[model samples]
Target: MTTKNLPIYQIDAFSDVLFAGNPAAVVPLSTWLPDDVLQKIAMENNLSETAFFVPVTAGNADFHIRWFTPTVEVPLCGHATLASAYVIFNQLGFEGDIVRLQSKSGILTARRYLGAIVLDFPKQPIVPETIADDVIAALGGDTPVETFGVASRDTDLVAVYDDATIVRSMTPDMSLLAKLADRGVIVTAPGDKTGLDMISRYFVPAIGINEDPVTGYMHCVVAPYWADKLGQDDVVGYQASARGGVVACKVVGDRVHLTGEAVLYLKGEITVSA
Candidate 1:
């Protein structure tokens, strides 16, 4: 078997400080690899997500990006995309302020903004939905103020609470959550701290992450939700995880812009059989 070495970078996204945010492993590829190989690599890394990208030649985008958790490939991932852009701009010497990436979700752009990376992603609008009783029970029996489901995907559900404290104190039953029809649940509330407009916690046991530290894509749903509730188009969100991080969000007509910082934690190589 032919073996090849691939460069990988572990980055702490949504935080300038190391070990404080969601860490994602990024592998820059010159060409596409097999799906099983990508999944295996992601599993080996054992992070929340691993990102792979190859330079694009005949499209409006600079590269094609994909994301994988340990168990499955996901449609959209925010932190890993930010990490991939960081590697491109800072490591690969890409001389541009904006990096356009085409993915399963469509065209996504990462721009250098005010000392942070701003990610322009499609807003995942949600509508009211009846949440399963077991799902609510798994969340410690505190019912949500409102429940919503993403119109674009069947795997996402949003639970709105009245206070940030409820969101922070949740200790969910992962087995019950994994059995739900929706694969991921996002619990959000009005921010309690200064300078923050919203707070959120993400749980996706079906995707192999019990609780994501500082989720980017989940913000796509929460940002618009909070903006409408607060009557402000721009707001800041804090993910109340063990290793918490902040994300600044701006909701436009049909898009959500997320801004955060990423710091490189490790740069190394992985050998894969080809």
Candidate 2:
């Protein structure tokens, strides 16, 4: 039996310290592999997300990146993308401060900002909508002051609470979240803490994550929404998960720039049968 050794790096994204943010596995592939193999690798890692990237000679893009959870391949993942950019800058000897990756969500770019990585993502449009009774019940039965439907991959429901405490104290029903079919739930509120503009928590059981410690994609949706609601373009958001993290967001036109720091946690090799 022949085997191949692949380089893998585990990184904690959206936090400068270890074990404080979302951990994502990043595998640098020389070429594209089978989709099933990628899924299997992600499943083996068992993290919220695993990122795979291959160098490309395409226009204005350094690589093509893809993200997968334990169960399925997701269209967009902010933490994993930030982790991949960290690898490119720190491990791969990339010279430029800006790294552009082409993904299913369109061309995403990561740049250095004050010793942190800033991600450029499209602002997910969220519109006020009626939420189902069961979904509300799944959110601990405390009705949200507002419910909005998200127009983005992975995230579907956005529930706005009047207080940050309610967003932080939610004990959601994972079984109900799993029924959302690849969609995730987001709960957010105005920040009561100093230095924070908003707070949020993400539940995405449908895509294999019951609770994401720090979700950048969720901030992309919430930051813009809060910007419009609060009449500010720049906002600081904190994810009140057990492994809490902070995201600095700036909304410009149709784009949202997310800034956060990542730390490398583990560097190892995975042996896969060829």
Best by TM-score: 1
Q: lDDT of each structure?
A: 0.93, 0.91
lDDT against true structure, model 2: 0.91
lDDT of 1 by residue, 63-148 (tens): 99999999999999999999999999999999999999999999999999887999999999898998888889998789898999
TM-score of 1: 0.98
TM per candidate comes to: 0.98, 0.97
Off by over 4 Å in 2: 180-182
Off by over 4 Å in 1: none
RMSD of each: 0.9, 1.4
> Which digits, one per residue and each the tens of the lDDT, describe model 2 over residues 1-274?
4677999999999999998899999999998778898999999999999999999886989999999999999888999999999999999999999999999999999998889999999888888788788888888898889988886652488899998988888998899768843478889999998999999999888878899999888888999989998899999999999999999999999999999999999999999874
Clashes of 2: 0
